[model samples]
Target chain A: MHEAITEEKWDIVIEPRSSLLSINWKEIWHYKDLLMLLVKRDFVAFYKQTILGPLWFFIQPLLTTAMYFLIFNKVANLTTDEVPPLLFYMAGVTCWNYFSETLTKTSDTFITNASIFGKVYFPRLVIPLSIVLSNLIRLAIQFSLFLLFWFYHLFVTGKISPHWELIWLFPFLIVLMAALGLGLGIIFSSLTTKYRDLRFLLTFGIQLLMFATPVVYPLSLASEKYKWLIAINPFTGIIETFRYIFLGKGDFNWIYLGYSCGTTVLILFAGIIIFNRVEKTFMDTV
Target chain B: MSGNAIEIRNLSKMYRLGEVGTGTLSHDLKRWWYKTRGKEDPFLKLGQENKRDTAGGDYVWALKDVSFDVKQGEVLGIIGKNGAGKSTLLKLLSRVTAPTTGTLKAKGRIASLLEVGTGFHPELTGRENIFLNGAILGMTKEEIKRKFDEIVDFAGVERYIDTPVKRYSSGMYVRLAFGVAAHLESEILIVDEVLAVGDAEFQDKCLGKMHDISSKEGRTVLFVSHNLAAIDRLCSKALLINRGKVVMENTPKKVIEEYSLTNYIPGEIIFEDNRFLKFLSLKQEGNNLKIVCDYDAPTPLEIPCLGFVISDSMGNKIFGTNPNYQPPKTPIKESAKGRLQIEILYPKLLNGRYNLSIWFGDGKVDYVVMENVLSIEIINMINYVRETYATASGPVSPIVEWKYDYKD
Candidate 1:
């Protein structure tokens, strides 16, 4: 029997609320341990029974890059602008995989997590944040493999030159891809709670978006009329900036990069607003 | 108001009836239009009372204007029939879902155990699931670590702590889950029928733990359960909710008595064939139960036997009585229809629901037999013992005289 009767006052007031600025940062901060556990669960539970386990992380991008090289470079004869086919396609594949994987996983947050969310009262944003963080770990592993190939090309062929612009461009491109993926993922997830048909459209839409990006071909190959069409895609600036900084082969423009950053911020805020609104009442409909 | 731990004011929750897909878009548009023009949403006014059997309108209020105050250290039992908004009330208190209208002011950290193993991942080990489940119930990592050994000891699963929960038996799983939940340190604990899991021994242990938490620690507890015996032993006050409304709030004994009297119906059946007896009404007055009927006899009968059987809710016969055991003082006359009332005193039945059936026959041939003609409920009012072992061996609990002789 441990009884301490103090006259401390801590009142919790609950009411019907529709406030756009009700995101409790302090509450989220308090549940940081739960968020870390969720991130660990996501990473560990994914490859529990698989024989290769985390080796699949490296193998996936390796196989995808090889297929892209064979199809685009050999069959379609796409140009890489003096960059080696291995380094060119691997850079694009590694960066795009992080973005697409984060987006796909985060977009299915409400559907895949209805059981946990319906029962508990933790901050709903923790699930998506864990998805993004877990995917970051996978991206780091694959990026190391890409650097292994980069060193091989550097020592054997001497065909690639690393640029000083990479000092700022590399981290900036990674953040841009993460923010963009998270933003769009939450937006689509909020909408998918009401309309499940959108989930079907998202898979094919991501596939089509890769062709619009500069993943297989350099941005310089697009004609002047179609270059704006490709530039409007935020990934174009990120992928092109990645290739230019790492391999020093593609063109990069500050204005297009700034545009992509601005769009990322806008979508992130919009996604947060929509996500906050949906998290409160989504249990009713879902 | 100052000493209250929870104060609910005019709380209500409205849900649309069916198919939340295509029709919701139009309703959303209409609601938005109403908001733009400074008008209330018309659908809110169309809500009916929540009766699952009846289909009436597009909207129903699961809880309607429920207001109550719980004292700082009182144990409150919420008793209700099915679909009586008990779970809805718990959900609102736990913040699982927001109310459509009204407000609740609660003082202290409210930990709700609405279900066992809420966030347990099958792929994770039992140790990891304890942390995960604890965190989901609003406990921090440090708190779980502090009670880690105690939880393992309580669950009696020390040998399988590192094994995946998927590999554990169902009994082990529930034990682990309840062990984690039992250690939650909150000022207010809200539980909803979670004790229905686990074995009888474990359930008794959980009841004792809940009693200790409330009485010893001076914490407020709100428990919703269908086990009237547990409610009688643990709760000081009870609230009876019917059709999404609070009907009564009083001491547990009085409220349970009123609830049983109003909730269950004592059935009646009339025999039109006129071969034997016609049933009238079966009612209970205090510990005395009386069954009234009419016996119409054509010819003079030497010996007519009449009996009534009592069975528990599961259709198991607890006990029965007949006039053949002891003859009546007076016999009925020939060609007379007379009202007969059979009164039994101090039957000493346990606290549970039961159904009554009546039978009539002469010494030579059987005349009439009715199965489950009436249903009645028996509640323990005078006996306040915490532990009653009679519920395990059989259903009937008759008070027999005891005589002890010392041989010294």
Candidate 2:
């Protein structure tokens, strides 16, 4: 056993690396258990003291849907492509919450985990990735509530119908949302570590982004002159395509879906590059 | 397969001083501009040594081109005064922050206990925190499971294992944190003054555990601490750092001796606020100690006192003497230079370092009070008690008369 130990070579060599592409994928894979435990911690810690516990997960999107229904559909007279207003708003709220929650939580990964990061050495990417995964659990719960309302409207009113497009399009839309959220979250997190100005801008910026996306109002209600303005948002394609797939009333544009996918991949790549670079030396500044 | 477990080559870390945000943007922009033109960073040359006393530069090198090697299973102690780059070296070794310019090649995993219980969440139960802390220390779930019972038992918190750590007392919290860190299976362990916290018993327990890890388990350990006795007991090899540079690397005894001597500031003006009395020298001659000072009395006083205090290395006062009780024969008057010498019989103190504080004043008004003016190393010149071993049982060894009466 002693001879065997002596024969083994060095396992790790630390150095001042200059390359932005020196991400250690194998080490991340090696620490997959840590990533999962972090996800579990986030999920459990979020509602540890709440009286309602996981019920808040469902109640949050439900209350938001009600508020949106009252303000946008009833007051502003916004259209929902002939679908039931509750179903429309619930669908939008569920999908939009998943993206926004993931983005907001993951964006604070470095700041929130600074104590842990400073004391230990693990793949820092594990933190943002865990945030993305944990938010998915909340999204899943909220999505179930949306599905319950959708099925009720389907049978009782016969106003909305399911589309075959959802079989492939639904998963694609979810992936797109997850990627975009994780991407933008890490990019802003990396920048915020050096200059905290971006942290203050992110809260209001995400709120404005929600309005820019087709969440409360249907894409078909957008005027032709302002349609491109909405289309410019990467989230617009995903949310609009999600409504189109589930309700079969909103327009489905393959070109827009393709554009959203491309943007997701681009942002995700850039975010990882920046995140990798920042993780190495963030302890110095942070 | 080399014997060296860690080889550090020209390791350095530079930190920008003051507001890092406002000035960083412009510096970054300028760096980028320079990089585009294929020139070296313009600001790299301005970094000075990290000296807390003087501020002259915008950047300081916390660790300046330090290179060292640690053989396998060596217990290396890093000793330095505050702001001496000891913690910064450990930080760089732990990869908490990357080096500014250097390379470190190491064999096997490294675990750094910079502080105990680094990632403990107060909301989590003791059992849950064990898993969390274990995972943060790079243990997998299966490994944590294997060591779960052992960790709880070692921490001696089995009764409250399922309760949240917030409810645990601070001692229990440190115990649990230390238990998790002690069970880490990393080959190289970096500890930074963690034993300074917790109680004396627990600190001794940790020192014992570190000894076991380095000797029996053959794990390489780098420990940094201000406790010289602890370093002397635990480390075979020690490194002394000063002003972000390694001043000496030698055996622990020699390094600690050199450290204490170098830290001693002799023939230096410790204080000069009033300047009514100026201390000259404190010298030890055989069994007698002499304190020389220059006294300048602004006005004649009824009783002027000259006093001195002697304290051990840990700053515990052993004894003090003042002439006020006996009263001096003459009063002092103002003069450009008036030398005064006071000699007292040195106590039969044990072999150790002691600090002397000198003061000269009238009965009520104080003229000068200089703290820690001189540090003297006492050596046992004669074994009067016939005891070869020098154990400091008390502050002073006094001869007491012994009387024995015959009893049936």
The best candidate in terms of TM-score: 2
lDDT of each: 0.84, 0.82
Candidate 2 local lDDT, residue B123: 91
Best by lDDT: 1
Candidate 1 residue pairs that clash: none
TM-score for the first chain of model 1? Answer: 0.94
Which residue pairs clash within candidate 2? none
Query: Mind giving the per-residue lDDT tens digits that candidate 2 earns over A1-286?
Result: 6876665466767776657767888988878888888888887788899999888887888899999999998999998889999999998899999999889988998888889888888888888888888888888888888888888888887888778746686877888999999999999999988899998899999999889888999888889999999998889889888888788777678888898999999999999999988898898887
Q: Which ten residues in a row have the lowest lDDT in candidate 1 chain B?
A: B381-390
CAPRI-style quality class for the chain A–B interface of candidate 2: medium
User: Which portions of model 1 miss their true places by more than 4 Å?
Assistant: A1-10, B264-349, B353-377, B381-386, B389-391, B398-408
What stretches of model 2 exceed 4 Å from their correct place? A1-9, B264-274, B277-321, B325-359, B369-408
| C-alpha RMSD over true interface residues, each candidate | 1.5, 1.1
Residue-level lDDT tens digits of model 2 in B100-184: 8888888999999999999898999999999988988888888899989888888899999999999999999999999999999
Under CAPRI classification, how is model 1 graded?
medium
Report the alpha-carbon TM-score of model 1 versus the true structure. Answer: 0.86
